[model samples]
Target: DVILKCDAYDGFTSNNSDENDNVGNPSLQYDIGINKCWKAVGPAHKQRYLEYTDEHISVKDDPIKTSVKGNNTSNAPKVEQTNNNHPSIVAGKQLSQIQTSLFQSLPFARYLNLITSLGQPLGHHSQTRRFRPGL
Candidate 1:
């Protein structure tokens, strides 16, 4: 009985070895062969191609092709005219009574340290000191 050690087995070919063995080994070979499946598919793909954008045959570009844009403008939720403000929410139910201090949810404003804030834990926007670059 004989046992091949380490990489020796890889180098030693046996009767059971693959005929395409070298094709899979990067050190032995790389260019397996020109993919001829494209030959029959090329013309068919070109036929359905969009003018400049993607076409029906998206395989060469994307393994899975899809035509749907999940949340595109067409399917997006419509904007509701509630008490919407640029920097804060409304303290009251209507836009006419907009006030940040009482109604503001300032988490995002505080986290990003934007230029404004209305509530606690004080967030980042409340800082007025800018040019000091230190204080």
Candidate 2:
């Protein structure tokens, strides 16, 4: 089982009214992924895909081929709304407003820091101050 995760910015255009006719910050961001299965299959699991060498089994002779039925795909959870500004909660569990802050949450605002070279840690802005074009 494998879990894939990705993040992307969907909107940042000069045409956007909010951008003031310039490229503005992304209006939408998303993190999407597939969660792995909880069940574990050991090395001996017959249904697991295997690599063979020298005189490998043919497709008809492969074990566990017929046992698999229905969709093998896993259903990923819906994208949690960071705009909600709420800590994550266990499924089927509710939290009082006061207790919610105790849980750690995603820091979506950090994405804004990537917008400018000055905001980066690589010192691009600091180096520019020392530029000596005449030299």
lDDT of 2 at 90: 18
* Model 1: per-residue Cα lDDT over 45-128, one tens digit each: 232211111122332343222122232234221221212221111111122122244335555446544544433354333211
> Which residue pairs in candidate 2 have backbone atoms (N, alpha carbon, C) closer than 3 angstroms, thus clashing?
none
Please list the C-alpha lDDT of all candidates, in the order they appear. Answer: 0.24, 0.23
Clashes of each: 1, 0
Report the error of model 2 at residue 126, Å: 56
Worst 10 residues of 2 by lDDT: 125-134
TM-score of each: 0.12, 0.14
Model 1 worst lDDT window (10 residues): 30-39
Q: Which residues of candidate 1, in runs, are more than 4 Å off? A: 1-73, 83-88, 91-135
Candidate 2 deviant stretches above 4 angstroms:
1-49, 67-135
